[model samples]
Target: MISACHQCGEPIPPRSDDIQLCRHCQQSPPAFDRTHAAFAYTFPINQLIPAIKYNRRPEALGWLSLVFAQMLEDRIDSPPELLLPVPLHPWRALKRGFNQAGLIAGELGRHLRLPVHQGLIRKRRATASQAGLDRSTRSANLFGSFRLTGTIPAHVALIDDVMTTGSTAQELARLLKGAGAQRVEVWVLARTPTKG
Candidate 1:
């Protein structure tokens, strides 16, 4: 079985319990209070998520959304009143033709019966791709990249396909909390495994 941290959803370290945070999450707690994810970002998942993002295949995530929703149904006692998909910069959205997070949020909304609010959180800056960056670089790159375009609910969830370093989630959750969100949770299809 693949066990995960209750806090960040990263795979629990060997011999560790699931109720604790991973080392990284403990050292630098994420801005979001909790993370809900279905699987680790490995094997077929690593391949499938990239294809869904780069290949414009939102349809491929349908089954994954349903499965994650099932997990959410069992785990979430207090669900978010709204869902916000991490937005892309206008230029990035134009180039990609869609935001994968938005698509994933939409699918998840239907399965989880939450209202997905897009355009509420806008990516105003077009920073370089975060693929090869370290944690600090990734955090700096996202600084001031996001803008709140609309009001937010007190309790809300940020929906995305993957949670890698949690940099993006940290930035967005900070933004949301700053904008009056009392509780912020993250829901994702997969979370990257920790490097030993």
Candidate 2:
């Protein structure tokens, strides 16, 4: 199995020694303290994620969440105090009839015996999908997009289905820390390989 970056959870090339930091994370760290992802955003698994997100396949979602929960249990020695699904804009949640992240978080929370807090952070406005956008554009699009609510916990894990450039996770983690969270970790089902 491939090793992952200790900070961002992106896959690292197989190596002889244990190097925990990826080059990008070493140069400039992310807002979150750490990340844990179950799989790379590739192959048939990639197809399954969209099917759960866009195609409204509950069975697929359940199975994927179970797999992710097992991965989390295997990797994390101590679970965070809470689980927070990356919030969706109200309009988007209404249109989709659900937030994919929330659905996954719900299952993970059950499996981990952690509380899933849905209202802790919310998207203030809808932004264009991060797909196909450059890293700078993705950051700009999410600027001031999330608002923190409720009491911020000392330790929390932000849940999402996929982490691509990690712009979204970065923005949310910054906000969480600003709102008094001592440590924020990201838990995602899959992570895309970093661009060269």
Candidate 3:
């Protein structure tokens, strides 16, 4: 839980008490419909995640899932029809023991009492990471990379660990929309602020 504004140092009421945004977020709305981040991607979280992913710390997913579920409790309407984790290239999935986002989504589904659907796939060839790319380039990197397989209900919530440029979500949403999905919204664990 955030006790004060990250940028301005103003006091922030607990999410349960009052507030969706600190003064900063109020001034600048996020790109997603309603962004919900359990904690900023800094310090322990940033360090711990890489260690967990690289060192095979599967237990961390449990804690991450619990925090993400609590943060999203108020925003999402009764369990989404489906929960879809952003897909990773097959090679990446192989390199990493497991898809962190998928693990998080699975835990979230369990907590929220929803079905976790793993029907979507990364159809495009693997490309460079999005860490250093501009918004346009980020979109280009993810373009045509995702395709839905099997059955997908009309409404599904996309899940990811961090939402930065939002290009990944945008592209995925575009594909889902094209495939007759009625509506698609992203539910990420973190939404990074725009940096100039």
* Candidate that would win on lDDT: 2
lDDT of 2: 0.88
Question: What's the TM-score of every candidate structure?
Answer: 0.93, 0.95, 0.78
The digit string of per-residue lDDT tens for model 1 on 1-104 reads 16677678888756644446777777878789999888888899999998988897878878888888888899899989999998888888888888888888
Q: What is the lDDT of residue 94 in candidate 2?
A: 85
- Estimate, for each residue in 6-47, the C-alpha lDDT of model 3 and write its tens digit: 322233555665564566557853333434457666677777
Model 3: how far residue 152 lies from native, Å: 2.4
For candidate 2, list the clashing residue pairs, or say none. Answer: none
Residue-level error in angstroms, candidate 3, position 179: 1.1
After superposition on all C-alphas, the RMSD of every candidate to the true structure, in Å, is 1.7, 1.2, 5.0
Candidates in descending TM-score order: 2, 1, 3
Off by over 4 Å in 3: 1-33
Assess candidate 1 and give its TM-score to the true structure. 0.93
- Say which candidate scores most in TM-score: 2
Model 1 poorest 10 in a row by lDDT: 13-22
